[model samples]
Target chain A: MSENNNYTFVIKPKRTLWEIDLKEIWRYRDLLFLLVKRDFISVYKQTILGPVWFFIQPLLITITFTIIFGQVAKISTGGAPEILFYLTGITFWNYFSSCLTSTSNTFVSNASVFGKVYFPRLIVPLSVIISNLMKLGIQLLLLLMVWVYYIINSDAVHPQIELLLMPFYLLVFALMGLGFGLIFSALTTKYRDLTFLIAFGVQLLMYASAVIFPASVVPADKQWILFLNPLVSLMEAIKYSFLGQGIFSWFYLAYSTIFTAIILVIGVLVFNKVEKGFIDTV
Target chain B: MGNIVIKAENISKQYRLGTIGTKTLANDFKRWLYTMQGKEDPFLKIGDTNDRSQKGSSEYVWALKDINFDIEQGEVIGIIGKNGAGKSTLLKILSRVTAPTTGQITVNGRMASLLEVGTGFHPELSGRENVFLNGAIMGMTKTEIRKKFDEIVDFSGVERYIDTPVKRYSSGMYVRLAFAVAAHLEPEILIVDEVLAVGDAEFQKKCLGKMKDVSGQGRTVLFVSHNMGAIQSLCSRSIYLKHGTIQQTGETDKIINYYLSHELKTEDELNLKVNKDIPACVTQVRLLNGEDQKTKAYLSGETLRFAFNIDCQAQGNYQLGIGIASALDVNIFSEVSELMELNNGTFEIDYQNIQVKLAPGNYALTFNLLYNGKSIQYCEKVINFEVLEINRMGETYSLSKGAGFLITQGKFTIN
Candidate 1:
C-alpha cells in the first residue's frame, strides 16, 4: 500500500508522447541560457579573431560562391549583384545548416553529461538554436552593411516590402533545423549509420534549397520539384525581399509553414520518447 | 519518521546483453508489432538474473529485479555491493538518469545526484565560470550560485586560480573545486556514488563533514560506496545487494560483516611464491593449532597461533605486526613485535600461545612487514578462519552473531 500522498514526481516505464513538460523546461531556463553561453564562447576561445569568425565565415563563403556560380558557371542572379545574391542565401543557409548539424549530435555528444545528471534533454538542442541565432544576428549585420552599399550605389537593386518578415523567416528556419535535428538525433543514438549520412546530407540539400542561384532559373516544368523542398521557398523569399529577385509566393510559403509544423510535431514526439532512455543506447 | 520521502514499488530494469545495432532494430520492430496487436512484450517474460560470472542462455538479463524499499527523510542509507551487482543501476534509476523497465519510484521533494564529481566542467572555462556552469548543470539557479560563490571558492581553497582556466589547474585542485561546488548543493534528497573516493584525505574529511551537515538538517541521503569504514561510520542502516537482488538490509556493521564473509573467498592458509624481483614481500601466512599443525577453525576461549614467513632480499631491521580482525575488518586486537636485525634470507616469525576470546563467527588475520617505521609489505585477510561455538563447563552454546567480537565470562551474584 502506498501511503505517501505528497509525492513530487513519479517515474514510469513510458510517458505519453505528447507530455512535453513545458513547465519543467521552464524551471531549467537558467541552465538553458548558461549552456547557450558555453556553446558560443567555447567554439572560438582559442581562435585569434574569436567571434569575428561569425562575420568572416559567411563573407568568405559568399565570395567563393559568387566566383564559382556567377563568373564561371554564368548563372543569372536576376539583376541582383552576384555578391549580394549569394551572401543573402549563404547567411540564412549557414544558420540552418549549423543548427541541423550541431543539434543532430545531441545524444551522442552529450552522452557523458546526460548519463550523470538529469535535466530537460531538449535544453541541449534549444541552446544550440539560441546560440546559432546570436551568430546569425552577427552575420545579418554583415548582410545589412553590404545591402546598404548596393542600395546607395546602384539603381537596379530594389528592397521589397516583404523584408519585414525577417523574424518569421528566422522562426521557420529554427523550427526546421530543430525538427530535423531531433528526429535524426533520436535515431542516431540507436543506429549510428545515420551519422555518416548527416554529414553529407546537409551538403546535398543546399543545392536543392536554391542557395547559390535564384529559384527562377529552374525550368518552369521542373520548378515544382525544386519547390517541393521545404527550404526552397524560404530561401527564395529571403533573396526576393532583399534583392528584389527570386519567386515569392504565398502558396509556397504556406506549404513550408505546414511542412515545418508537421516535422516539428513528429520531432518532439520522437525526442520525448528517446530522451528518457537515450543514455542506455548511446 | 518523516512520512517516507522516497518509495519504490517493484523497480526492475532489464538490459539486452549484446552490441546494440541492426540486430536490436529487428527486435524493436517485433516488439512494436506485438504491441500493435494488443499483446504483451514477449521478451519481458524471459530474462535471467544478472550474474556476471555465469554465462546465461538468454540474451536479456535483469540488472535490478523487483527492488522495493522506502527511504524515510533524513535517513542516511548505504548501498553496498560487489561490481556488476546493480548498485550503479539502482542509483541511475533513482537519480532519473535512466528509467526502470517495470517499476515506478515516487519522491516527495527535490532530488539531486552527484553520480560524478564534475559532470560538465569545460576545460576552456575559468574556475569562476565553471562554478556557475557546473552549478547550473546540477540544477542550481544563477542567483543561488552567486550567493554561494565566495563560500564555494573558500571551501575549495583555490581562490588564487579562480580566474585561471581549469585546464591549467592540477588534478587535485580540479577535484577539490568540483567537490566544493557539489557540497554546497542543498536538496531534499542527495544521491552520491563513490564521489568521496576522489580528492586528498583532508578534502575527503571535509566532504564527509559537509555530508553530515546535510543529513543533520533532516534531508535524506542515499550513499553508495566501496569504503566499508566510511559506510559504517556515516550510515546506521545499509542494503547489501548480490546478483541483482537485495541479499540483506539491516544494521551497517552486520551487513558489512555479511558482505565480507560471503563475498570474499575464505581460506585458512595463504601460500605465495617468492618473487626475487621485489626487495621484500610477504611470502606465506598460516593459522596453526597447539601442536604446530596448520588449522583454520578454533573453539572460542582457545589459544590462537599464527606464523608469518617473509622474504628479505637485503639485510635490514624488520618489524612484523600481527592483527586479528572481525569479519567486518574491524580490528579486535593487534601486536607489533620488537624490531629485530636480520640478514638477507627467508625467516618465519611465529606468534604463539595467543589467548583467543573471540565470539563465534568468521575472522581474518592481517600481516604487516615494515622496514624501519615504513611498511614495505602489507596483506589484509592473509588467512581467514572461524571461531566455533564457545564451550562452557560441559555444554556448548552458540553466541549471537551480532554480540560484539570479544567473549568474556562474568560472575553473576544477584543480591
Candidate 2:
C-alpha cells in the first residue's frame, strides 16, 4: 500500500443523493466502538442507582400508565395482561425515544469535542444510536420477564410465531429514529429552536403512536390516519406479533419499513452535506 | 524526499463578524439562491478585507484567503503569527473541522489534530475512559490505543486518578492527560495547535521533547505556536503568516529573522503605544555608534551609544529614557536619564549601550520629557533602528535562544 500510494486524495464533486464513504467509517470503527462504550458508562457513573435507572425509568412509566389509562379510564389491553402489554410498549417506546432525543442533540452535545479534533462527524450520532441499543436491550429483558410470567399464569395468552419478527421491527424503529434524529440534529446545529421543541414533540408523538393504548381501539374512522403514522404501524406490529391480540397488516408494516429506509437515505444525504460546513455556522 | 502528504491549494475561509445567528441565516439563504441560479456565491465578492482585528464596513471578513501550501512527508513545519492573524483558521481547515469557502485540499494519510486540550474529554468519564475517548476522537484505532494506553497514562502522570472522573481532576491534570493521548496516538500526520501551553514548565518541556521525537520518527507535523524558542528548536522549516497570508516560508532561522525584523516590529510598536505613554517634550532621537556619537545602525552583541538631544523650553530635573520592547509589547530593556544624571544645560547624554544582546530584529525607542515627578510631554517612535546579524571570523552566533525578554545564559541540573 505504501509503495503504490499516490500523494493526493481527491474530493470529487459529490452529486449523488448521499456521499457517505463507508470505507472511511469502517476505518474508524474502533473509535466508534470506544465512543459508544464511553456513552454507556458515563450516563449513570455518578448516579446512586447507576444502571438501575434504566429499569426504573420503564418501571415507573408502566406504573403511571397502568393507573391513569388502565384503571381510571378503563382502557383495554386487547385481552393481554395490562402489565405485560404496557411493559412491551414502554420497552420499545423508550428505546426509540432515547435514540431520537440523544441523537438529536448530537451536534450540540459534542461541539466541544468536534471543535478540537478531526474525526468524522457521523461518529457521534452513530455512537448515540449504538449506545441506546444497550439501553433497549436491558428494557427488552425486563419486558421478557413480564411476558414469561403472563404466559405461565394466564390461559388467554400464548406467544405467537409473529414474535420472531420482533427483531425486524426493532431494526426498522432504530433506522427511522436515527434518520429523523440525524435530520433534526443537522438542522439544530443552525436553528437551535428546533432542539427546544423536540422534547414536547416527542411527548405528543408518544400518545399518537399507541404506546399505552392499542391501535385497534383508535376508532375505525381514524384508522387510516393511524396507519399513516409509521411508528403506529411498528408499535401495532410488535404488539400483535408478541401478544397475538392487536392489529397486524403486512401491507402497512412493509410500507412502514420502506418509509424508514427512505427517510434514512435522505437523512444521511442531508447530514453529510450539512456536517461539512456546520462547524462554521454553529 | 517522500511524497507530499498534504496539499492545500488556494483555500480560503470567510467568517461573519458580528452577533452569530443573524448574518448566518441571511448568508445561507443567499448562498442557496445562488446555487439555484447556478452561479457562485454573491456574498463572496462583497466581503471586506481579510483582517479580523481591524474595524471594517462589511460584517463579513475572510479569515483566510488564497492560502496555498504543500507539506511533504517527514517535515516538521512551524506556523507563527500574532493573534487573529488567521493561523488557527488555517489549522481548522486542514483538520477538516470546517470546510474552506473556496478551493480544495488533498491529503494522503489519516490526520489527527490536537487543536485544543481536552477537546473530546467527557467530564463525567474517568481519566481512563477519557483517554480512550480522546484517542478515538483523534482517529486512533482501539488496538492502537490499547497498545499504548499504559504509556499514555504514565506520561500524563495521572495514574492515581486514572479511574476517577476527569471533572474531579485539576485542570492541569486534565490537560496533561489530553496531551498525552494526543501525542501518543500514532497518526500518519499530526496537527497540534498551541496545546502545549496548557501545562506547567516540566510538562511543557516534556511536550517539546515529545514533539521532537514525533518529528524524528519521520511523521509530518504541522505545529502552530507563538513560542519562537520552541519553534526554532523543533521545526526544520516554518511559515510566517500576517494578515491572513503567508509573509515568508523557508528555514526556521531565516523566516524567524524576517518575521522579527519586519512583521514583529509594527505590531510591537502598536501594542506598546496602547499601554505606555511616550516620553514628553522630546523630538526625534536615535541610537548611534560611540566613536561617531551620531545616529547609526547597530549589530547584535555589539556595544554602541544611544544618543538623544531633547529640545526644551525651560530645563528642569527632567528624566529621559529609552526602552526596547518585543513584538508582543513586552519591554526587554530600558535605561533612564536619571541614572546618568544628565541635566538640562543643552547637553548630550550618551549612554554606553552594553551587552547589545538582542536578536537580529528592529527595535523602537521612546524619548521622554519629565519634570519633577510628572511627565510633561512624550514622543514615541522617537527613533527606530535595526539590529543586523554579525558574522564573526569563521563563526556565526545565532540569537534564537533566551525567549522571554533579554538573552541570558544559565544552566540547570536535575538532582
The prediction achieving the highest lDDT against the true structure is 1
Off by over 4 Å in 1: A1-7, B279-281, B297-304, B309-347, B353-415
DockQ of each: 0.62, 0.41
lDDT of 2 by residue, B1-415 (tens): 5688888888877887766775668777888999899998777775566665567887778887787888898999999987878899898888877788787888877677778766677889899888887777777777888899999999889999999999999988888888888778776788888766657788888888888888888899999998776787889999988878888889997887677766543321111122223232444344566456554355566775665555444535667666775443346777666723334334555567676577755566665556675766566554556655556574443354434444455588899
Span of ten consecutive residues with least summed lDDT in model 2 chain A? A6-15
* Model 2 residue B219 distance off true place after TM-score fit, in angstroms: 2.1
> lDDT by residue for model 1 over B1-415, one digit each (tens)?
5568889999999998888866888899999999999999988987688999999999889999999898888899999999999999999999889999998998888899999987899999889989999999999999999999999999899999999989999999999999999999988899989866667778878878888888889889999998777787789789999888999999887788778767866676899888776567778888887777888777777788877778888777788887888765578988888997877888888887555588877788887888877787777767778777745575554333556788777799989
Residue B170, model 2: lDDT of 92
Looking at the true structure's interface, with contacts defined as alpha carbon pairs within 8 Å between chains A and B, what fraction does model 1 recover?
A: 0.75
Of the candidates shown, which would achieve the greatest TM-score relative to the real structure? 1
